[model samples]
Target chain A: MNTYDDVERTGMSTQDVEETGMSERAVLLDFPGADDLMAAGRVEPPSAQALARALAGIEAAVAAQEAGHAAGRKKGAVATAPLRGMSGRRRALVGLFTAAAVAAGVATYTNTGETPTGTRSETRADTASVFLNDISTVAATQSLSSGKYWKTHLTVGDSYLSKSMDFYVVNDGKAYKKGRQPDWQLGPKDLDWKALNQLTTDPAKLLQLLQTPPRPKSISPFDQALTLLGGSPASPKLRAGLFKAMAGLKGVTLVGTVKDSTGRSGTALEFAEAKSIGRVIVDPKTSSILEYTFTWTAGASKGKATHQTYLSVGFTDKIG
Target chain B: MKPDTRQHEERSDGAPSRDGGSDAQLTRSAAGDAAAFTPLVQAYSPALHGYFARRMPGAADDLLAEAWLQAFAARRTFDPSRGSARGWLFGVARNVLAQHLRRAGRQEAVPGVEITDPWQAVDQRLDAAALAPALRRALAELPVEEREVLLLVSWEQLTPAEAAAAVGIPAGTARSRLHRARGRLRDRLAPTGPAGRHLSVTGDMA
Candidate 1:
């Protein structure tokens, strides 16, 4: 029937069918077959194990449905989610790299613990060191379970650079998924969860490894400490070590309590850059990071800092 | 962050096809009949998977599961009189995709994955991939709405009406979009003297 026979069933005309066929041929040719995509996408055919997981999610659905019905049928009865807000600078950072590069932002690995030799500002003194050692102790007291992958969702509030279209274009910068909020995947690329847990809680080793590569050039050791310590799903011991290591950095100093743009209150740590002030907010209660904020300390973009908040960070049972 | 720029030369395939009578299976599934849902899943999963695979690679299965989960949870609301179960399912899938696209960023410059060059991995004709790269460029140039309709109709093998139902647009609008998209494609893919090889390929399609 030349595929035209199915027109009535498909609600399409003969010409529509032909054109669709032509165009569809182009799409289908891209993949070898269903299995090829399934493999690439890591999609398995509803195995027994998967069915169990589906059943669990389904149970949540049923309970939500029953609860909603009991409460007179809410519009949100479907029981799943997605979200947060957008920031321009956050978008630029996420947009600059591909999903693999951005999601796996810290994929670069360097086993060597050779600290880059540089000037150490003696002004940091013993006070900051003592305070940091104390915070790392608190970090060590945290008790959280391990998971498969570490996911972090963040948004940029304001433009990182001066809001100039020509400059933005010349920089060849991209504001990634401006409309769609994204959660970054941070494990399985350069380091695994086990390796992260096994690393000693020593500050020097933490600083040496993190200050390697695949990070933005503007990222200082303090910023590196924030990204690694704030963004990772590190174990309590490792987190403690990271906090201590960060404390040892010359420029990283505690800035006391602060509230994120979301109005969530947390202790703030600020890193002074030439033109910007980078801040990491840690939830004092859990010894976990809450946000990484950047404010323009000087220049045309001065006084404008964008805060990137962590929506959720956890270990999933498997890669999605 | 740059969008895809690779071109593909793929081997030809047979005519497009569809799976029908899913409405009955969907009705059966709603009645708590697990077996009834099996046939329906088997029949329609490919189209749904393909729908997501085109826009988001390596996410089809997860997205597909999310869609089905929504579909099954909301099965009681399915009104066959309004449209085909497959179309309704497509709508649910689109919702799931919207969520994923929101939750995760897209890979704009996905190589060997773009519609232009499916044959990049396949062992086939060396010159079969569009030499002019006009088709893909034209595709990129088409309006997002028009492109969605064209893709649904062409890529998903949905009739204009079904595509409309899937995307929640009117059937007439989808038809117009389909027509406009085809016209734009024709304009861009039109024969040029030096692109005779591509001409033969697209001409065969025409």
Candidate 2:
């Protein structure tokens, strides 16, 4: 377990406080649904089998655009919208963002190859574990920017509630403590950056670090790993380690390719809960999480289960 | 929250753009540069599919096609200054959903397969999982306005402003509504002194 405790937590910058007009902001108040909201709207990239269909649709869409373009050319449609990120306002926005912001994220205009290849790293690990590890690589490469806050959009796919939500952790030294559930609301109060900075890429050490101070007997190592992966602003190395650890946990098994509610297909990992089947769908190519779902494999809600589809996750310039 | 009569209009439909193709490409697409539009389609299709999938489940693919077709038909109307191309496309999706529901009439609320249990059944395996069923029920019980704002920010990852745009409300109104909704959720999720936390429900947003 790597603890950068030798380094004190970074304090909120004077500029951040003065500009954002916020101080002592602990738990994210505006963005709600840490539990219930995690289960919505992340579209998994097309699967290998669905590739042809998607391509065909893309062709049609392109053709439609072509037709529209031709029509516009014929009609001479003038550029009506704000003239291409060049306005004074856009410049101001661009100004607010320095090299730091550019380093922080790859803006859409500058990003390329956004589509998923539908290819997973060839690994004998649990396909799901491979997926988690793979996605960690994606995050690992992303640059972090110094900003007012760090945000995450995560989907929680539990038995009865499969949900998605956006979570924010300011530079303030507070994180969900390593103990109980409701207590997590009051969990370890420390600098999130410090803990994340202390994260070790080594899966074994990372796993041990995650269980620091120990957790309730009811909480399995799998649960703890998940808590960090889904909750913390962990480095990609840390996220990958968590996935590797998750693969080693009992009851975590490959469930094969599964289509999410949105009809996108990905490899799945399933673990049996007392009353339901806990499932995770992972995009093979990007290693990004597609969905989390818990279906009642038994009991009254047998046919009922909730799922959270993560729309997107990243460190962004804005919190909204 | 009481789910809306017209979900597309009533709920938060500010679907976040994944590929985030620039508005320029959309401009090109409108001008008939079909090639310029390919990336946009590739970028947006999966997310568009998800948008409908949550509402109509398996019908997501077909609805996605219809929405794109409609978008192509009205590509000229897209004004980047007013909003984003994705946001505009989502508005189109909302319209398509509305049209689909209007055609279905009384069956509007029943887009996906109907589950027998009004009470969604879920079993908690560990300490964290225990929170699910409890929150699910409480979520289902919230007012639609608050629920809409909450889900827009929390689930869709929309900024309050984006949620405002998607849900057709003032940004301030969206923020206030989100605040109230969060309050309700906080009361239900972390009750006073860890009382009976497991009560009851999130209506199927799907």
lDDT (Cα, tens digit) per residue for candidate 2, span A81-140? 344548766644543343234222212111222432211111112223323433444434
The local lDDT score (0 to 100) that residue B41 gets in candidate 1 is: 53
DockQ of candidate model 2: 0.08
Error of 1 at B7 (Å): 32
lDDT of 1 at A36: 24
Model 2 Cα lDDT, one tens digit per residue, B24-67: 88777655464675566566666566556555554455556555
Interface RMSD for each of the candidates: 16.6, 16.0
The native-contact fraction of candidate 2 is 0.19
Candidate 1 deviant stretches above 4 angstroms: A1-320, B1-20, B31-35, B105-132, B192-206
The top-ranked prediction according to TM-score is: 2
**Interface quality of candidate 1 as DockQ:** 0.07
**A1-320 per-residue lDDT for model 1 (tens digits):** 02222222332323453455433323322211212212222212334433343333333233322333333223342322211244755543433332233112111211122332221222112223433554575676655675544445444322211111111111224433223222212221244344455556676777556555534356566665666576666777777887767655555544445677778766666678688888887765556678887888888988886767875555543332
